[model samples]
Target: MSYADFARSIGLGGIAVDDPDKLGDAWGVALAADVPTVLDVRGDPEVPPIPPHATFDQIKSMTQAVLKGDPNAWHLLTEGIKTKARDILPSRR
Candidate 1:
């Protein structure tokens, strides 16, 4: 079950947000609730979470996993590369 559903089952307030733009609003609703709240924010599963200071071993392991025929190999690799690139490259904004 989704986190929101799980939270509701446990008697807490739950807010599920699938859109990135609605995250702030979700947080607002969650914070304003009388009961404890769970803000379930959905994001792209293909995009791996890259740490700010990723180690060489970590990159190697992820690459090996992707090369081992993980179902979402292409997306995992591409998104990882993009994430790394953004870290290395200067910000345009």
Candidate 2:
């Protein structure tokens, strides 16, 4: 099926994706380039590929800023959320 049709059939109604592997690519880009996986850096067998960059305090501060409707945090938080939502969308159907 066309990715769009598959997406719609699966109830991924508004999202757009051209390729399945693109999700992994996007994750790599985001995890490396954009926001970074500031959460959950602990890896299998107990070794992490990248050291934790942001502390819980920093994360909490960002969360608080977001909840308080700070503009910069809004863009940052929504990009993180949208990237994560995109990662999970294909599994719903």
Worst 10 residues of 1 by lDDT: 84-93
Backbone clash tally for model 2? 0
What's the lDDT for residue 50 in model 1?
79
- Lowest summed lDDT across 10 adjacent residues in model 2 is found at 39-48
Tens-digit lDDT string for candidate 1 (2-90): 89989999999988998856777899999899999999887677776778888999889879978898888888888788767866887
Runs in model 1 lying further than 4 Å from the true structure: 46-48, 51-53, 80-93
Segments of candidate 2 deviating more than 4 angstroms: 1-62, 65-71, 91-93
Instruction: State TM-scores per candidate.
Output: 0.57, 0.28
Q: Report per-prediction Cα RMSD to one decimal.
A: 4.0, 15.3
Clashing pairs in 2: none
The prediction achieving the highest TM-score against the true structure is 1
lDDT of 2: 0.46
Tens digits of lDDT, candidate 2, 22-69: 555545644564322222221132211222465667757656766686
